[model samples]
Target: MTGGTGLFISFEGIDGSGKSTQARLLAEHLRSTGREVVLTREPGGSPGAEEIRALVLQGDPERWSAETELLLFTAARRDHLERTIRPALARGATVICDRFADSTRMYQGLSRGDLRGAVDTLHALMIGVEPDLTLLIDMDPEAALARAKARATAEERFEDFGLPLQQKMRAGFLALAAEFSGRFRIVDGNRAPEAVAQDVRAALQAQA
Candidate 1:
């Protein structure tokens, strides 16, 4: 599937929404067709961003205040854009990012409602880039939360927020999709992985 120029695609959802899997599947599909694809994720993509990821994801849920956490996420994203995403796109590659600025908007905003404004302002001032296409993997929060719990990783910091927050995040994502309809595509994530992959493929193919 080709989109005229360098395509920047980001997959976003609450933890366990199966976005990561879809991102991988799409990357593989593109590579099989002879396209140069760069698959990446946030709050870790570049080496410096990955370091920042460890600090944010491995600590106690309350280790950093909401404001502090937002800063860290922003810093990581800046590093990721400068060191990883921008270069790949410059080389005319398709960059498939598992998560992007939207996560910070939803998570930070959902956790501390007042910080939503800060999130937006910081994004405009610091990050300043948006994906050409964003696939929002929509799903039932309870099911997704269960999937997140099953993983039991050290990065449980975000997953540890549990069901209620996941619900809020789902809403937050939908809201963002509405706000940025030009670049967002809401994809159902309740189906089998292959089915979901096909739907994602179809969505991009239509755009192409």
Candidate 2:
């Protein structure tokens, strides 16, 4: 429904919710079924976007204000859509993105301030697209934060925001799922990866 005949699936949640792993698993499963699958992540999908990703993801939490971060993320998403997502979907390939605009809605829109209106306006003007299905991996903030910190990656800027931010984000994502219940599927992420994956596949099938 998003692009031609292809399916656009996005994985979203708080930091260390295991959505990325689930995204990869879903891509592999689709590919095994002989469907063309493009497994990608936001903030750094295309070359241009990848450059912006480094700028936004690898610094102190206060390095960029919420407004500036919103702009940077929107720019990255635009480039990603042009160079990666749209093309893949137009070609009838399934696109499994690690995160999408829902993230912006929470991180920039609500986390820093009440900028949901601005985020929505820019999204409509620039992106104008949403995933056909969004898989929300719901998890406890404390556990999720632990997992995120365990990664210790350079792109841990969001993770470095600590537990309170994670709690806020988890609540925001749940609210978002309700806001877009038509296309959003909530998956319990506290279980093992394989079990969670089974639920994810079930959600996709139900969508079909």
Q: Which candidate is the best by lDDT?
A: 2
Per-residue lDDT for 27-139 in model 2, tens only?
99999999999999987899999999999999898999999999999999999999999999889999999999999999999998799999999999999999999999999
Q: Model 2 Cα displacement at 50 (Å)?
A: 0.7
Prediction 1 TM-score vs. true: 0.96
For candidate 1, the per-residue lDDT at 21 reads: 94
Top of the candidates by TM-score: 2
Candidate 1 residue pairs in backbone clash: none
Clash count, candidate 1:
0
Task: Tell me the alpha-carbon RMSD of every candidate.
Answer: 2.3, 0.7
